[model samples]
Target chain A: MAVSSQVLSYYSFEQVDITRFRIRPEINRQKVEAEFSRAVYPYITWTDGTELYAGDYAVLIIRSDNPKLCRSGLKVTIGAGLLGAEFEKALSGKKVGDSFSVLWKGETVFVTVESVKNRHKPELSDDMIAALNIPDVKTVAAYQTHLEKKELDEFFFEHSRDAVGYVLKQVQANSSILVTEADWNQTVEWSVNRLAALAAMDGMELRTMTPEDFRGRIPVKSYDELVVLMQREAWESVRMSLLGEYLAKQNGDTINADGYETFLTEAAAPWGRTAEEYRKAYPEAYYLQNEYCDYFRRAVTAYVRKNYFKEEKNEH
Target chain B: MSIKFAEASTFDNLVREDDFVIVDFFSTSCGPCKILSTFLEDLEAELPFLSIVKVNTMEAPELAERFEIHAVPTLFFYQGGELKERHLGVLDEDELRERIERYLY
Candidate 1:
């Protein structure tokens, strides 16, 4: 349902799930171990034909008729969907040394199960933290805190996105807002770069890596499909930004100097820098263009949250 | 109810009195600690047999240091006077419930 381009409804912020706020720390040793194991290079161990369990950790070698699709030493956990369905289907119930060929993108890709390793959940001890090489994470407690903070920040950011979505939906309902070609291009480029960055994090180069090669890694079929999806996402992003700016102007409430100062101080304190030091280092214009605008967008969303939304407090 | 602790000996007594104990290292200034305090209270009501031990790091620096508590809202689960698990940061109600259930069952 498309909203009018000009008029934003008041109930936008109230409709979404604002209660999805709590972020639990990954304290379960089993879960933490599984995640850590997947991130690292899986160990290789030859095994006889045995029924592969759901949680089996293994390294697979994929060979394809398409030169760009051929890949080797790809570490994956069984049944995680990190590898596409074909790879899973090709390997499931088959034991070590199992090989199968599947047609992908008009070419046959041969998959071979090279090695399967019995993964043990490493104890979240000081030694494990040292091996991780994460700064200031010298102990299990520190590591848990680090993970918790990361998850918590992600939760808040997601909540903020929902809040912005609320505003955008109302804005769309009221009037016709136009998407410019420049904005569309910027959004598409941003999506491409973001996807590349994600691929890089997973130890793959996206520019050279073909869609067929990255089948199990990402949820894209062809380059054209990726462009279409990114275009849709970029449009939504641009619309949200436009609505946020419009709502901020409509509210006529300037930034709270004290709140802004506290925000800046808190941000800088983690890096051992004072608010003044941070301000001196980064130009006021730069902060206004990026940080200040983001803060204002949140403020606009929060205004809707406070005035229109009923924060259902969880009694339990 | 969470028993307040100011030193190591008090913590020792608190743990010794209860078979299943959870020590919550919290600070007055920490917002998450305040939220967790209410959750822990709800948990205590749910499992009346469970005992909670509260240690304010600001008031008892030695106890905090002894426990290696670098952050507030850190939870230390104990069974039979031995540390079973340590969880730092905020936990949802379901997560807290699940943790207790695992030990109880």
Candidate 2:
């Protein structure tokens, strides 16, 4: 598929932080919190190795103006990832002033319960629900049961797609320009260090600490073994990047799904495994490869549309 | 009550004393430096065996320049005016503790 012009309009990863500030401060706390909730929260650590916050950098919720919302309890919605689910569970039944720690994005973060606020919980009115569908639901429980099975799934799927779209848009905007080896190295090193910190939080040491001690703390077999696994992961990512660059040069257009299966089959040949076998061994890898291919294709289309197609349009 | 600040002017006097000296060079704006500051403050409270000195880059630009500091935060471990090891950027509290333990003990 050709890259959408909308994808090209996205800002780079470095620009993401700057964009957060562009929102007006006058906006309601709920809206601000909603926006902040979408941000990738970093693991907060004190200088003394104490973790202070486990959830997202920020969180948002809606409730009735009645104080009963505080006493009745709260529900928090997090992303689908492991950390997200964990945060939701941790926040459940938590009252104000309660402090706890949980693994967030692989690192342990400490969280304190902030003040609970009362706000309007937006729901489809009963009349509106009836107007849309003739299903005569009696109680809130029946309506909730109906919504849970289908609507929740649709809502999450839509949000997930939007999040991925945002990242892809960023990648497209950052395309065409070559990243310097220094810049790449810096980013990679920072990622590694962050990973190391996460491992440390899990009580697994990257160096010096014994394997048994590490295993007692983390779910991994050994620190050395984990290091090897991490290295392999990094290598695959780098290899995919090289493949993306190669495809970008050859096609002149982005390599979309039409080229994906062939590319995977050929790429897997060097590893003594068929594409199908590789997919079986690492299903996530296949998904990542497809995504990267799609990104590359979008970048090519974006480059073409911005330069060649625009020029053609101008001529007309 | 004597509130003796860790000033560069007192470096020579501190060298004559019988203690391991740690000079922390840090800027106010650096995240790592800010973290290290709190760490050093905590270390000072807990470890009475050694002297932990802090030098703000804003106030002690001359000392920072003398040390060839190109970064916002740098830690110099010293014993009797001799430099032992230097660390740059953010460090974990455990790591810092171990470093101190190694040097002091």
Candidate 3:
């Protein structure tokens, strides 16, 4: 059965004038120039005595003997400094055309230093711009404008969150859902039990954990207050999840194997898991419901922000 | 639930005349659409007052797009040319009957 049918009524009306949160972002020229430098000739020089060193760019072929290595065989040309502390410790003072072996993160790996060279950051100049081979850009002024415009776009997207946040806050506040008593109890119990589980993880019983034990860490004054906060949190969770679920379905989000796998991969990233592992560990309905919540939030924040939370904008 | 088959050219005309109409947006290749058709037949025999209008979504691409029909076997209920409710998926006989009965004015 659909969530709407179960809820019986989810009267969500009244639209927020998203334009009220209009934002104009200022571009930082220094940052834009740095980004441009990074974008162009990230690693292009080839005159550093062919020695492997920090800040030098090099082509390397990497292979691991460990069968369960994250990436068994990887080869690329990149900045040696970008490789991390483990690599710096092992690869310092090495020479080009040399093959060496090192133990990396518990995995025995082989590295071949194909070529080593120093890459210098180019100055902003018309000559550099001409060398860029960009179709319409052949001057330093044009290049600077291009980088500044790109930076401005990025800044705008970052700052536009206020508009999306306002829309979500307004809709969530205006909407009302019919949560059954059993559902409310289940939500509250589930949230409290998670807290209990956290207490267990820290070798303490939640029932016995005093206010002073929680003080300076959590804002709760007593166990009863904590439970009350948990209930409020649970209600908010349920409300947001239901709204997200309804919005996603109405916006053409469906259950497909490929889409679900993609969702699983992105959703599991913070939890330190692969898509398959997440699928196995997360309960179907729980993750599915959470997916909608995530999707709705993202949809509201995306470039298609004008689509969601529109009360009568669909009028044709 | 008397089945009133509607082509794209006649769909608007069909809905325009009925006081209450259930427009079934379906695809010929859809298995659920086939099953739902049989249930609609039984429903037609049961609820003589119900108006059932079937549109092959495959044959009526424009109509499907206009109604935002994403899935097969979607039903759009109309009362006096205004959309009242939309149900997606194949509903069983009893549930389908119940869904239609409530919309009756």
True contacts kept of each: 0.00, 0.00, 0.00
lDDT of each: 0.60, 0.47, 0.63
lDDT of 2 by residue, A237-273 (tens): 4433544645555557453356556554544432223
Please list the residue runs of candidate 2 whose C-alpha ends up more than 4 Å from where it truly belongs after superposition.
A1-316, B1-5
Better of 2 and 3 by DockQ: 2
Fraction of native contacts, model 3 = 0.00
lDDT by residue for model 3 (A236-299), tens: 6676677777776676777333367665655443222346655544445545555656766676
Scored against the true structure, residue A257 in model 3 reaches a CA lDDT of 36
**lDDT by residue for model 2 over B1-105, one digit each (tens)?**
011245668756664454467777765556677777666654443332347667766566566667766565788887657788898777767778677555543
- The residue-by-residue lDDT of candidate 1 on A173-212, one tens digit each, is 5545566787568667766765665555445676677778
TM-score of chain A of each: 0.34, 0.24, 0.51
Candidates' TM-scores? 0.34, 0.28, 0.41
TM-score for predicted model 2 compared with the true structure: 0.28
Could you give the CAPRI-style class of model 3? incorrect
Indicate whether candidate 1 or candidate 3 has the larger lDDT.
Answer: 3
Error of 3 at A62 (Å): 37
Which of 1 and 2 is the better model by lDDT? 1
DockQ of each: 0.01, 0.03, 0.01
Docking class of 1: incorrect
Give one digit per residue, the lDDT tens place, for model 3 in B6-71.
887888888867567888887665677888887776554334345789987656667776776756
